[model samples]
Target chain A: MEQLKKAIRERGKVLSDEVLKVDTFLNHQVDTHLMAEVGKEFALRFKEDGITKVLTIESSGIAPSFMAATDLGVPLIFARKKKSLTLTDNLLVSQVYSFTKQQTNDISVSKDFLTEDDRVLIIDDFLANGQAAFGLIDIVKQAGAHVSGIGIVIEKSFQPGRVKLDEQGYRVESLARLHSLEDGKVTFLDETVSVQS
Target chain B: MEQLKKAIRERGKVLSDEVLKVDTFLNHQVDTHLMAEVGKEFALRFKEDGITKVLTIESSGIAPSFMAATDLGVPLIFARKKKSLTLTDNLLVSQVYSFTKQQTNDISVSKDFLTEDDRVLIIDDFLANGQAAFGLIDIVKQAGAHVSGIGIVIEKSFQPGRVKLDEQGYRVESLARLHSLEDGKVTFLDETVSVQS
Candidate 1:
């Protein structure tokens, strides 16, 4: 977690006061070594949850989720953002709004993948508005699966995402929590605040 | 490789004469253990090449590429299929036609990620027309980077992808090459046939 905060400070770019672009290491071009460490952090946090599966959205979340799933020794199911030719109709669908893209898209997972017997851990790269995570939780609930916990690489605590998930009674753990991005600078939540809240 | 072949034979579905869907393990829902093996296979094949970075497209390619990059002990950069707010204009872009979706999409990588000093190995989930790989190669070339080789999880040998890459003088190593998907039965190229040709 300290490594993640350090990476955010050293390599992360602040596009605007609201957007922190971690494409250098977190999303677009990834540091697999850092990702492995992030995965280990998540695995350590959720080791006793009896997680049967790891679920994440396509694209950005796959790498970290794959690493975590590998460490947790469970299968990973990524919810598809687009309905491809190979994706069948028997799927649990949910619409998610992307603040970065400024558009709404449908996300889906096959019914065959998630079942009532499965305990799902939803993972993502960044939690901003919580739309994507909420969408994934909706799909999991639709399949009658239990939501074990949520693991995030980076979170914008200034946003309402964390509070929203907490109000819904979900255990959310993030490696790095950003308190603010003001004047093209990133301010992280203190360790005590991050852990206590 | 044997594990991949066995997974295909057991779980792969022949959607049509041309489309063999292995979403059960290779893509959509991934078997992390098997993917680690696939990664090891790619690492063993290209271990001699000085691979500085592993490149692939987003979504499906992230899982396998992550494993391969982890095994190779390098950074992995995945080209973004769509332009997002976070992706800047300083990029090397190329167009790729997807036979599955029947659409052409622009793929781009940040100029900061790939440099002339970097030696890249492109990895993908499946190869049919070699369009995605070609596009990735184009971007890598645009950045003046050297491509060490290409690794694919599955290749449709009946298609022109393999021959096309061969004609272009790229070293391509696929874990499982399917000779045919005719009659709803999947047939794979023999070990000798796969290695020699």
Candidate 2:
């Protein structure tokens, strides 16, 4: 978490008042060493939840989900953003609106992968409006699987995603939470009020 | 390699004569233990290249790239499949045609992560027509980086991908190469031809 926060402060660029560009280290280009540490932390945090599978959306969240699966010693299932020709009919599909892309796309996973006996731990890179996480949770529910907990690398706490998930009684843990980015200063959410970026 | 072969034989479904679906353990749902072994195998194969980075395309390739990076103790840079508003102007882009999806798309990478001094090892989940690998190699070339080698989990030698790559003089190492999938038998091109459903 410290390394991630440090990287955020060093190489990450703030595109707008909303978007944080971590292509240098976090999402596009990954620091596997730091990711391994973060994965271990997630597993430790949700170790007692009886997680049977690690679920995440495609593209960005794949690395963290894979790392978490490795650390947790469980299988990882990622929802592909596009329905490829290889996809079968026996799939649990859900539509997710991407605020970044400004488009609604369907995410899917085979029904054979998830069953009632499985407990899923949802993971993602960023949790903004919580649309992606909500979509994933919806698909998991469709499979009759219990949501163990949600793990995220970065969370914009001011954005109501955590509040909504909390309202649904799902335990959510984020490594770094951003309270506000007013005046070009990143004010982090902690009792100590640490300035990250 | 044996583990992957066994997994494909056991859980992989032959969707068609050409497509082998190993989503149960390779792409959609990942087996972390097998991936670790895959990483070691890739490390062993490209051990002499002094690989500075593990390069891959987004989505499916991230998992094996993570494992390979962990084994090699290097950075992993995955080329994103789409252009996002968050991406910077400085980028290396290439066009790729997906036979399965029946569409062509541009893949891009931030110019900062890849450089002339970097020696990259490209990794992927499958090498069917080799279009994806070719696209990745083009991106690496655009960045003036050296592609140390290419490592694939499964190579359908029946396709033109390997021959094209070989003609281009890229050293390709595939863990399991399939000669043919005629009828219900899957014939591997190894010393011992094995069959799988």
Candidate 3:
């Protein structure tokens, strides 16, 4: 977790008060070593929950989610994002609005992947407005699958995502919790976790 | 490689004469253990290429590509697929047509990730028409980076993708080479790669 926070501080760029670009290591381009550690941390935390599958949104979350899923020896299911839904019978779908893209994208997973017997661990690259989390949770509910918890790589704590999920009674864990990106400075919400070496 | 081939034969569904749906493992629901083997296989084959990075398109390619990059101890950069190009000056962009989706997507990589000094190994989930590979190669060329061949999880040899890349003088290594999908049966061009127990 400390490694992720350090990576964010060192390589992450603060473009504006609301946007933090981690293209160097976490978003566009991924640092595999750091992700491996992040994955292990998530696995360690949820090892006792009997996670059936690791669910994440496509693109950004796949790397860290794959690592966690691999560590847990479970299948990793990434919900596909679509501009619009086809209203298919065998798909569990939910709508997610991205503020950056200014669009409402439908994220769906096949009904064949999730079942009522399954327990899912949701992971994502960032937690901003919690729209993605809400969508994923909605889809999980549609499948009648239990939501074990939500794991995040870099959480923008200044936003309402964490608070919203907390109010909904979901346990959330994030490697890097950003307190603020004010004045082009990357500050952490909880810096108690020391960097490993 | 054998494990991958086995996965294809066992779980891979034959959708059409040309289309093989492998969402169970390689695409939608990823089997982490198998992908670990795939990453190692890619790393073993391209060990001497001096690859500075492993590149792939967003979504499906990210899982196997991340594993390969991690095994090789390098960075993994996933190109963002956009409906249309933003025409950014610092972005290396290429257009790829998807036969399945019937859409032309603009895949772009930031100029910051690749340089002339970097040697890149491109990896993808499927090599059907090779449009994705062609687009990625073009992006790499635009960045002045050397292409260290390609690593595909499944290659439809019946399609012209392999032949085109072969004709272009790019070394391509596929884990599973499909011969045909006639009558909803998946056949391999190279089942000669025995399954590892």
**lDDT for each residue of candidate 1 in A1-197, tens digit (9 for 90 to 100):** 89999999999989888899998887999998899899888988999999999999988898888878988999999999988898869999999998878889999999999999999999999998899999999999999999999999999998989999999999999999998899998898884344554
Q: Pick the candidate with the highest lDDT.
A: 1
Q: What's the DockQ of model 3? A: 0.55
| Model 1 CAPRI rating | high
Name the candidate that leads on DockQ. 1
lDDT of 1: 0.91
Kindly report which residue stretches of model 1 are placed more than 4 angstroms away from their true locations once superposed. A191-197, B191-197
TM-score of each: 0.96, 0.95, 0.94
CA lDDT of each candidate?
A: 0.91, 0.87, 0.88
Chain B of candidate 1 achieves a TM-score of 0.95
Q: Model 3 scores what on Cα lDDT?
A: 0.88
Over 4 Å off in model 3, which ranges?
A: A83-89, A191-197, B83-89, B191-197
Can you tell me which runs of candidate 2 are displaced by over 4 Å? A191-197, B191-197
Candidate 3 lDDT by residue in tens digits, A91-167: 88899998878889889998989999999999999999999999999999999999999999989999999999999
Candidate 3 C-alpha lDDT tens digits along B1-197: 67887888888888779878787887778999998889889999999989999999988899888778998999999999863222245888899998878889889999999999999999998899999999999999998999999999889898999999999999999988888889998878765465758
Q: Write model 1 residue lDDT over B18-108, tens digit each, in one string.
A: 9988888867899988898888788888888999999999888988888788889999999999988878699899999988888999999
**TM-score, ranked from best to worst:** 1, 2, 3
